[model samples]
Every structure is written in C-alpha cells, then in structure tokens.
Target: MLLVPRQLLRAGMTGDVPYYGGRFSPAQAYAAAHPQPRPAPPPPAPTSRADQQLAALQNLFAAGVLTAEEYQQFAARVTP
Candidate 1:
C-alpha cells in the first residue's frame, strides 16, 4: 500500500505473484503461455489425536480468529 506500489498499480505494472486487479504480472503472463502441473506433496505421517487437536487450535490462533483467552479455553479442552 506504499506510494510506489500504489502508483505502479495505478500505472498497471503488477509485480510478481500471478494476476492482480485484472492485470497479470510479466511472469504470470509468461507462465500462462506455458502451463505445468506440479506434483502433489506426499501425505503427512499420521498424527496422534492430541497432536491433531493441538494443531487445529494452533491454526485458529495463528489466523487471529481466536483471542488468547479463547485460545487458552480451547487448548484446555484439547489437552484434557
């Protein structure tokens, strides 16, 4: 949102990282001309029930969808 970037967008000079504001960056346009399919990642090793619960809570907290107090409350439920 800086002045430079804002001006670039205004001038239609989108940078790297796919299309934005209905305009594709130079790299994105090139990529579109040549398509490639990436291999999917290997499945993760199975996790314990406790580990799964902890991960879920961590994701929610990291996304700021849960306050610290709410996080602690949910974490207690997962741990015990």
Candidate 2:
C-alpha cells in the first residue's frame, strides 16, 4: 500500500513543483536552449538525357516490363 499527501500530489500534477522541482532538469533545459542542426536534404538527382534513360530502364526492369537481359542491353547503350 502507498499514500501520497493531497497537497504534494496536486502540486506535482499542476506543475507547481515538478518531479525535478523545476520546469525541466538541467540537461533538458540545455537541450531546449540549443538544438542540433538538421542535415541538409540530399542533392537533386542527375537530369541528363542518358541519366534519365538509364533511370527509366531501371524502373521498367523493376516493374518486370523489361527482362534482365533487355535492361542490361539498354543500359549499356545509354551509358556509353
């Protein structure tokens, strides 16, 4: 069995006296003041005609529209 004083319980729930006796612990306050920078988005994909053709061939191969042999043959043409 456990018992909590009503006033203390109310204070804890209403943020009058948080678990840490403050709005946040030292570490949490520091994190709120200084957040890490987010990584930049990845570079845009290549848009050259050959690159586009190669990507299209890859999609077709993935969808089973082009056989492995056909994909390889078309890719060779696009790359060189």
Q: List TM-scores for all candidates, in order.
A: 0.40, 0.41
lDDT at 43, model 2: 100
Alpha carbon RMSD to native, model 1: 22.1
Per-residue CA lDDT of candidate 2, range 1-80, in tens? 44988897788788894467546898899999999999999999775989888889999999999999999898988886
Reference-based TM-score, model 2 = 0.41
lDDT by residue for model 1 (1-80), tens: 37665656755654433446778878889999999988999999765898988898999999999999999998898786
Please give the distance, in angstroms, between residue 33's alpha carbon in candidate 1 and its true position after superposition. 81
Model 1 residue runs over 4 Å out of place are 1-47
